[model samples]
Target: WNVRKTSNKAIHGVYEGVTIFEAPAKIGLNQQAVGYVPTDEEWRFPNFGEDTAHGREFTQSREGTFGGDNGTKSVLPEHKVWFFYLQRICNHCTYPGCLAACPRKAIYKRQEDGIVLIDQSRCRGYKKCVEQCPYKKPMFRGTTRIS
Candidate 1:
């Protein structure tokens, strides 16, 4: 949701190698502390020769370059990078609790909707949602990077 760190801003992820990008700006955005976090939708798929999975592989800027240096810095206006993370990727919610609480009856699911949504207008930002939400979905954006 919102930033959980301030002093030690670390942009972390895992990748086998930089053979191809799941998306353009995958590196620059990540380096710039952009929001698009890798999901199953943006992963390195299996080989195309095999029938496991199919995905296009993009060409790199140059040959022989294995990895690029992530130039991350404090986004304190004077710094070079702005730290940010998008709170959209739902990790299988394996018995998620956020779906378990909603006194306003605002948060609901639709048979055709196929996804859980929160009614922002009803959200009092009681911040109880922050606690109940194991993933901390209810984040309020602000200047300071505090939970």
Candidate 2:
């Protein structure tokens, strides 16, 4: 959402992180200090039909998908303001919610390695596990390659 130019809707400035502001949120667009949407998380330099590993579809997601927000909700500035920290992914969890949500009886933690896997043959992609998994780990891949 580089939005190199600004609009009245949601202005996603990249000067720092992807900072989205609602219609009411105002900023000087023509100013030299205009914000730039962070490219590290959301975009990758498209390699033009050459890099299969970095396909077009994959590059489309170079910018991380927006979640938990309704797209540029609102965040007013204040001298003594505090903002909610965004959630970032880390490997460990005390009570793994994903392992318990697989309905096919497919999910289990490895005794030796403590790893969990879903049996593709048994998975119906009903997304029951998607909804039930508290941690939101069971990603529902739309690609036929997975199912």
Candidate 3:
């Protein structure tokens, strides 16, 4: 999330600080990797890649099919094959379009922390916020009829 080139116009002049952290080693496909296991008390804290109340926050798509005309064999050399993944998340902009577009005023940003939140009680299932948001962060939940 580079703020300098972000699409959110409100934060165009704002400078956000970032701290880099080392990522966990990649695990082999279809195999679980050994790692830290939190206790019941510690489990209250959020863990990276854990399932959220909204289910998985991230979505993955296969860029393209690899391998063969024969259906199981690879025509390309093993050395030439490569894989890439791209992940997207909410930017939580200084001035969120979702907040402004919500006719019911369900979406709001906290002045103290600047975190944007939605009031499910106030939401009427109108998707104006979803239509206005450029980043596509405010997803509409059809099951609950809210955004």
Candidate 4:
């Protein structure tokens, strides 16, 4: 709801590895439910397998939001289940991984707020900081190889 009010960015859920808020699901015996999410009324199944579950799986990349380079799809079990949403944010660690991984000394940790930041002027765009970040918060722009 906050996402809707703030930037109005489309909020998508990571289901079966893909970034999607709704997907095809099986509801009850021989009944098909289209575009299912945890918030949906049909998501709650009185009985397990007979009521609700996804019929097929659509695999997505670990960087699901960006759809990265590693997206894939596969089959998954069909059964009623409850999905839990887990949110991950930048930890702003005392010893920041991004700050430590920048070979060009481009990333820094602010003393006041302890927020990790990148110095774009010095950034060679090696994406070492992107790789080192556990939450995968750092983003690389322009090109991958760095001109």
TM-score of each: 0.33, 0.33, 0.41, 0.37
The total number of steric clashes, by the backbone 3 Å criterion, in model 1 comes to 0
The C-alpha lDDT values of all candidates are: 0.39, 0.41, 0.52, 0.47
Please give the ranking of all candidate structures by TM-score, highest first, separated by commas.
3, 4, 1, 2
Clashes of each: 0, 9, 0, 0
**Least accurate 10 contiguous residues by lDDT in model 2:** 79-88
Which residue pairs collide, candidate 2? 14-36, 14-37, 15-35, 15-36, 42-62, 42-63, 42-64, 43-62, 43-63
How accurate locally is residue 138 in candidate 2, as Cα lDDT from 0 to 100? Answer: 57
The alpha-carbon deviation from the true structure for residue 43 of candidate 2, after best TM-score superposition, in angstroms, is 19
Which should have the higher TM-score, number 1 or number 4?
4
Cα error, candidate 1, residue 114 (Å):
3.6
Q: How well does candidate 4 match the true structure in TM-score terms?
A: 0.37
Against the correct fold, how does model 1 do in TM-score? 0.33
Off by over 4 Å in 4: 1-89, 143-147
Tens-digit lDDT string for candidate 1 (1-147): 457655454456454554222322454322222122222222222222243222232312244222223532222122222233335555434333444444454454444534566676776543443445666564433332121
Rank order (by lDDT, best first): 3, 4, 2, 1
lDDT of 3 by residue, 44-128 (tens): 2233235533233332225332333354422322222112111235687865667666678798777677778889899997777
Candidate 3: pairs in clash: none
Model 4, 44: alpha-carbon shift in Å?
36
Query: Which tens-of-lDDT digit does each residue in 31-84 have in candidate 4?
Result: 222221222222232223333343223222254322223553443444343332
Q: Which 10 successive residues of model 3 have the least lDDT summed?
A: 19-28
Best by TM-score: 3
Winner of 1 and 4 under lDDT: 4
